[model samples]
Target: MSGDSTESDVAQETTDDDGPKTHSTSFKIARALFGGVLAFTALDNFRKLDEMIAFADSEGAPAAERSVPAISGSLLFGGLGIAAWKLPRLAAGAVATFFVAITPVMHDFWSRDDDEEKEQHAIHFLKNAALLGGALAFLRVAQDD
Candidate 1:
């Protein structure tokens, strides 16, 4: 405890024009957990490319064939970057962009006629909203750094 902490225990600190900021172990864990989830999900999407493309098309996504791969790639890159604290700004921005671009379009709960489907889509939309918040917070952290 007196010396440098291990990866899990390490707390990163950085200073900016305003003051100093500290990234706690909890923050790092949160980043890793969420980032890993996104990364894994992207890989899975890639594995089921045809299925994902079809889903995207069903969701009324334009140019689903091209956009699906591009989005998946960005997700993978952003997730890995954030988890590893590499290119943190770009990573966080990518995540934010992904959420902003997809949440309303893909999870259009308001457009659903079935109550159950609407509720499901609503939940997904809210979840993406929360994740977008996290991405913004991470972006701020990166900016401080």
Candidate 2:
């Protein structure tokens, strides 16, 4: 009889409340938006591979031509995984790695002599860094879950 009572209490505690479930809906939308950015960027990269490769070559990353496909594919699938809340940690880690690896290579502000170029590169570098931080935060949240 005591065990039955305890089970009933547990079930009651787990029951859903009558309040709006907006928090969950908002989280889902946020996740999809986050992943959408990555996926869209990946698609853009694929669509303009030649132009991207040319830009990379101009930036002294000639090998980017060979690597763009793999990078774009990672972003596409990783973003999808994140949006779907499936293997989010892994997806976030991959996105984070992409940002970290590309930041220095693509946004080498220190290597630029022109002030305008330097400032532009610096902005891009910092933006990527901030994105990396967001990805790390996502990973931490996923781990907490």
How well does candidate 1 score on lDDT at residue 64?
Answer: 94
Model 1 lDDT per residue over 88-136, tens place? 9999899889889888889999999999999999999999999999889
lDDT of 2 by residue, 1-145 (tens): 5455475554444343743222367667877888888889888999999998888778886478787677778888768877887888899888888887778989999999999999999999999898788778766656544
**Model 1 per-residue lDDT at 46:** 100
- lDDT of candidate 2 at residue 63, scale 0 to 100: 79
Index of the highest-TM-score prediction: 1
Runs of candidate 2 with Cα error greater than 4 angstroms are: 1-23
Model 1 residue 135 CA deviation (Å) reads 0.5
> How far is each candidate from the true structure, as Cα RMSD in Å?
8.3, 7.7
Which clashing pairs does model 2 show? none
The C-alpha stretches of model 1 lying farther than 4 A from their native spots are: 1-23
lDDT of 1 at 4: 75
lDDT of each: 0.86, 0.78
What TM-score do all the candidates reach, one by one?
0.84, 0.79
